[model samples]
Target: MNLIKYTSIAAIFVSTSLIIAKILTYHFSHSIAILSSLVDSSLDLLTSLINCVAIFYAAKPKDEDHKFGHSAIEDIASFIQAMIIFISGILIIYQASMNIVNHKVITFEKVSMYTMLLSLFMTICLVLLQKYTISKTKSLVISADCLHYKTDVLMNIGIIASLFILKFTHFYAIDSIVAICIAVYIIYSAFELGKSAFNNLMGREISRQEQDEIIAIIQAENRIKGFHDFKTRRSGQMSFIQIHIEMKGDLTLFTAHEICEEIEQKITEKIPNCEIIIHKDPC
Candidate 1:
């Protein structure tokens, strides 16, 4: 959790620096490609700030009013991030189209390229840290932020490529074309992120593979006759499972409970950060 918080802070700092650098780059170059990168960095700052707040809120303990915990805050944060990214993409598309019509000529191509290189280096470093944090924490919020940075790395590369083409070809329209392409990719990314958030908000079930694994674990218990009413859902880092197992009618209640405990332990070993409720039924 501390690592997640630190990574989120690092993202904010990196985005802030990128926005400052890109602002200068765009001012000097007047390139729509640079402008697109600038817009993305600006939004990255806002998204990182939002992620920080959402993660802090989501870390709160479950209360009487919110028994499920505040994990849904992470989903809400992702939804808002999607909306923000979508709007930025549209705005960039409009700006790029206008540049195309006006026949905008980009200057300071070398400066913009250098700035993009810097941005790329910083973004890659942040993404590496985020990857490590996600591996340790399995945080959805951090994963979403990492996705944004990954896209920024690609955007930086695209901007550099556009600047290179313009430097040699003297074809000004390429800047606007690259910007538009970047905008389209940004919108596509927003859609993918939004869909995942929406599904999680709707209490989507665990994956089929995980469900099969759980089923197999249950079936391995010879004392249990059968099981039914198996249901699962995920919230933040937690998986909630509810299932009823059938057992021999002659078994004592204590024995039945012990069997259930054994099964629960096995499942827990298989899947960490999961809460299980196993109700025993007499066959």
Candidate 2:
């Protein structure tokens, strides 16, 4: 299995474990902070489930039905995940505000601390796994998944801090405030993730550096005079590039075909997991 599949599986496992821990903690203390953690973990579980299915479909090779490929399904999945996160954030904020207004006090029990510590440790491990998967695949979906886990790490830390404050200072209001802050942060991240996936679905262009590098490689070849109509886009980890190359009118058809083949090979080397389509035009 690929890194993405492995990461998704690990995410699902960790999220499930966290949810159980959060439930146990919440039952023990009835703390809003702990409940907030439970909410985050529930979203994580849902997202991971969706991601597993998305990755499975995204990995399928191009078929007759999907001429362009099924890779972009991952982006769609990302957008869905973002929407879920946004909804979860809004709900969290509303709950936190209600708790604050009602003067709900959270009594921190020892079990709550233990659960929080375990959650923190699990989050750290998941973060490391995400980092490794991203390094191996350079997949946007996996990167977004990593970002979610990283955000979870921060949220867990904030919850732990709130617990500590409530324990020592006896300021229960701080717990609701921390929950509200976490909700806001989650909403912001959801917006950013959704924007990125939406742009990709809208056929966003590739990076300037990649474009420049492709142009340079093509121009360096002696057989190619100049090129135009260069275009590039991405689907999951795959990049597709199309260009029209100017060539000598006198060149034979076989020679031109060879040149195009060579150019395609060079480009494939420069950018792994890329498809290059060269169109020949007489200069």
Candidate 3:
């Protein structure tokens, strides 16, 4: 929990700082590309705040209302984050279109490029930190926020390139063109992100490899005659598995219980942080 909180706090600081910096540069540059990237950074701050709240909810224990667990909060939060990104993308495209149609002259100094470079460096650092947190927590919110920031990295690169070209060619349209392209891509990615979170909320099955591994583990036990009715579902970072195990009719209830426990232990060893329910049937 501390790790999740700390990671989110770090992200908030980085994104907030970049948003302020980008605003200053956009004021001086009036570069649509810089403004587009600034819009993304602003959403980044909102997403981080959402992630922190989601992580807090996900940490809650199972209660009467939430008998399974509180893991799905992360997925809900991710869906909302995607919607936020989608809105920002649409707004950027509108702003860029207006600027292009108006034939506005975009004049930006080297400071705009320098500002983007600084944002790029900080984003890279924050992504590295997020990678470490994902390795530790396997959090859906963190992963989704990471995806958003990665696009920010690319947006920064495009903005910097556009500024370089505007400096030389004096082409007022270059900034708007780049911003429009970035915004369209952002909208496309937002749809994909939302789809993934929606699937999790709808109780998507675990991966094929994981199912095979579980079957293999059950088959490895000779005393376990057979198995059937296996099921798997994922919520946030947690997996829930259910299976019915077959045993010889002659085996005592105690022995069958022992076998089921052993098999469950093996499965737990293979898949960490999962819930398992096993039913024994005499064959």
The lDDT of each candidate is 0.87, 0.86, 0.87
Full-model lDDT, candidate 3: 0.87
TM-score of 3: 0.91
User: Can you write out model 1's per-residue Cα lDDT over 107-171, one digit (the tens) per residue?
Assistant: 64678888999999999999999999988977767877887789878878887888888878888
Looking at candidate 3, the ten consecutive residues that score lowest on lDDT are: 137-146
Q: Estimate the TM-score for candidate 2.
A: 0.91
**Residue 153 miss distance in model 2 (angstroms):** 1.3
TM-score of each: 0.93, 0.91, 0.91
Q: Evaluated with TM-score, which candidate comes out highest? A: 1
Backbone Cα, N, C clashes tallied per candidate: 0, 0, 0
Residue-level lDDT for 197 in candidate 3: 83
Candidate 1 Cα lDDT to native:
0.87
- For residues 72-187, what per-residue lDDT tens digits would candidate 2 score against the true structure? 88788878889988998999899999999999878879898899889999989998998887878776667777888888888888888888988899998998898888889879
Native-to-model Cα distance after best TM-score fit, residue 44 in candidate 3, in Å: 0.8
